[model samples]
Target: MAATLRDVTTYDLKLAAPLAAGFVLFFVTPLVILLALSFQTDPQGGHYGLTQYVNFLGDSFSLGVLGSTLWLGVKVTVLTLLLGYPVAWLHQRSPGWARGLIMLLVLLPLLTSVVVRTFAWVVILGRQGIVNATLSWIGLIDTPLKLLYTEGGVVVALAQVQMPLMVLPIITALSRIDPNFADASSVLGAGHWRTFRKVILPLSLPGIVAGCLLTYAAAITAFITQSLIGGGQMLFMPMYIYQQASTLQNWPFAAAISIVFLVSVLVVVSIFNALGRLSRGYANA
Candidate 1:
């Protein structure tokens, strides 16, 4: 009779039980409570129904807030991708020392507190800020352009804060690709841009999707960045939810908006997952 051996991974899987239990205790518990709260017809918890969700869905202004929040995420993600991809590509092509330096610079933003970074942007975008001062010195403008407390300002600040999320994954993806593929393309008479578009880009789409998903989620729900950069006059979903819950003491409606925003984000994430799957197939093909 032959002796049977046990699977090693079975023992390894047991090591993660603590983490799984902790996630259930901390994350799932609060989420379940929030979901329960959202169904209440009033903040007092006297009744339970979909009144809050109905009120939010039926209102035009509420819908606009959600729409604008999603659009803002799109702008920030696009801007970060456009700016970060070049940096990642450069890092991939650089010497080892240069690559290390580039990675350090990319990660430096994450080391600092986000509030500190947002405040730095506030200073930079002020009327007497670096941007205006430089432009004035260059004789480009007679007066300072309005930069602070605007959508443009919020997008710029969020992009800078979130740049690492966009860059790091692309770096990982690019590093995995075989360098010989590029050489083969070149040997086949493909120019640099053509080789990149045909070979490098398809291989990198999974990374791009991951980066976009992360950046989009962060940008949309960034309460501090939105509040500081956009100010009170402009409203996003995060702030709208805050006002309803904190200011007005309307927990049911606030919870409802939170659920709507959460579902909207999940839908966006699912679309990204689909894109990621398609990109993986294209890359494999």
Candidate 2:
């Protein structure tokens, strides 16, 4: 028994050491670098101090950007869930060749570059673009409305781009639910809505929470789509950070903002995870 235990311990160390090193390199390395840079001086010699954080936290403009970014995140998350749930249900219900085709269509965006996707939105949402042209043709509006470069445009663009990320996980989760459970509930005289409410929804909560978390985090830090679609008017935290770091040459402050965004995402995900745990316990009970 001692010999067997010794071999198992040796095998575990062999498996864990490389994984631990890779984890540190992949996750810890950048965090260490960012923390160091956040305390370093920039070209303006603002000095190594909490001034960067203070400037980020104290400025109303920055606060407004943070608020807008948070709101945008929430909107995108909700919209994704709204669309993703139905699509996931469809995939599960069909789970056939049609489902594969539908999934392929849903995930096709993943194969394309984000820049290309954003540019596509620019074309579609432009003043003389497909959407406005269609509206004008139908006499819905006499003139091309200002659709591009607005909050609405940003929301739509973000939703379209982050959709696949939301749908895939949900469909995966939904497909795993045993249909027999639903069948049994229905045969027991539980109506469709009741079965869905009591069984299907509760089972899928993990996936829904996961999808929401992914969409929210991606929406908050999204730079390319936000920058292009927002038309330099909207100020998301990620774009603001880019402007500060590259355009304004304020590395320290940029680093601080980056750290702030990172912390915010971590906190949000942590809260969701805690809620997820409590929800699982409650549902199981």
Candidate 3:
């Protein structure tokens, strides 16, 4: 028994050593490098200050990037919820092949590459694209409406891309809810709207919270979709960071920008998680 226990311990240590090393190499080492570079000066390679951070905060360009990214994230989250709830509910209530079809449609984007998906949006939203041409033919406008290169374009693209993330969680949550609760509410003379507002929404808050967090996080860092659809005019933080690190060759400033974005994303997500928990508690009570 002692020898068996010793062998198990030895094997565990042997497995953990490589994993620990890989963790350091893959995650920790890069984070440490970013932290170090975030403080270190560039060109002069002098001792560091908060100059990069201050510059990022003070620069109107960088500030605009942050604002746009956050605003787009909010828009995407809200729009996704509006569209996703119905789809999720349908999926939950669906029978037989209908449920399978709905789920397949919801998850179709997951199998496709981001670049390919964005390109497809580009075609659909282009001036001579299907949407514009259809609208023009229907006498909506004499000209092809400018869909690309605007915030609206970015939101539309993002919502489509992130819809699956929203739908899946909400459906899962909705599925766990007992249909008999709605039946009971009806038996008690509650209408559909009241039952949904009081019962269904409360129970599904967890899934809503999870989906919103996932959508918001993805939107905040969205790059290719924003770039292709926004025509480089949308300048979100990720794009700004990309330019600073790759184009400008300012590693320290890039690192600082990355850290700032990381903190901002974490703060927003924490707030969302907290609200979700509080709402869930209130619902239970």
Candidate 4:
């Protein structure tokens, strides 16, 4: 006799217990300890107060570092979206064989270490690098431009490094869109730009939001790329926290800074979540 069956994974809460326990033990427990430590006035960990937090928030330099890091994320996210959208759209529009080649190129960056990728940017942006050489060949300037160790350099490098994060989601979203919708818009006498602005863009809002969130988070916290491209002079939150914890040995202040950064990131994530909800409605309309 044949037996009837159904998917058990959908309803099996018990299957997730071990994962939940692991998360609690590894993540939640450490986060709680860190939060508690952030309240301590002493690095030694017993004297509890808001001194560390007050020091951070009340200081202008510290606030500037936080603001600059967030701004850096925004710049990187915007550049990535602008560059990635075209690549994704191209991938979507390409023929079957071309799609495979485009996808390979997109996935190629992920195969290597981030450090390696970042160092490649370092070479490319250096005084005698390809950019300067190209500019010289074109007579754009008599001298090599200072590209490395600048904010612009950091933004460009981060965008290249984090591009796939922005592109892949957009490709997925674009693929889901019905081709007939575009054709219908054209039939309704909408020009290409009008169809894209009205139909394609609205439908792709969810993917754009997802891509932006991922790119923003990665770009801001990219310690390796930031350190290599931005140099010691450009101080962001990751470097600030590292200096406090490792160099100065001020664990309490580091913990406090970390908590504040975490809260700020959570706020950004909440905004993205709200955008995602709005995008769904916008897409429907």
Best by TM-score: 1
lDDT by residue (1-285, candidate 1, tens digit) is: 587887765667677999999999999998999999999999889799989999999999999999999999999999999999999999999999999999999999999999999999999999999999999999999999999999999999999999999999999999999999999999999999999999999999989999999999999999999999999999999999999999999998999999999999999999999999999999999
lDDT of 3 by residue, 1-285 (tens): 455444543454676898899999999999998988999767356788888889989988787788778888999999999999999999988897999999999999999998989989999998999899999899998988889888898899999998998999999989988899999999999999999998899999989999999999997788888888887656888888888889999889999999989998889999999989987797677
How well does each candidate superpose onto the true structure, as a TM-score?
0.98, 0.91, 0.91, 0.96
Q: For each candidate in the order shown, give its overall lDDT on alpha carbons.
A: 0.95, 0.86, 0.89, 0.96
lDDT of 3 at 223: 84
Q: Which stretches of candidate 4 lie over 4 Å from their true place?
A: 1-10
What's the CA error at residue 162 for candidate 3, in Å? Answer: 1.0
Query: Could you tell me which 10 consecutive residues in candidate 3 have the lowest summed lDDT?
Result: 1-10
Better of 2 and 4 by lDDT: 4
Tell me the lDDT of model 1 at 255. Answer: 93
Q: Tens digits of per-residue lDDT for model 4 on 1-285?
A: 578687775787897999999999999999999998899998887789999999999999999999999999999999999999999999999999999999999999999999999999999999999999999999998999999999999999999999999999999999999999999999999999999999999999999999999999999999999999999999999999999999999999999999999999999999999999999999988
Q: Rank the candidates by TM-score, best first.
A: 1, 4, 3, 2
Would you list the clashing residue pairs of candidate 3? none
Residue 99 lDDT in candidate 1: 95
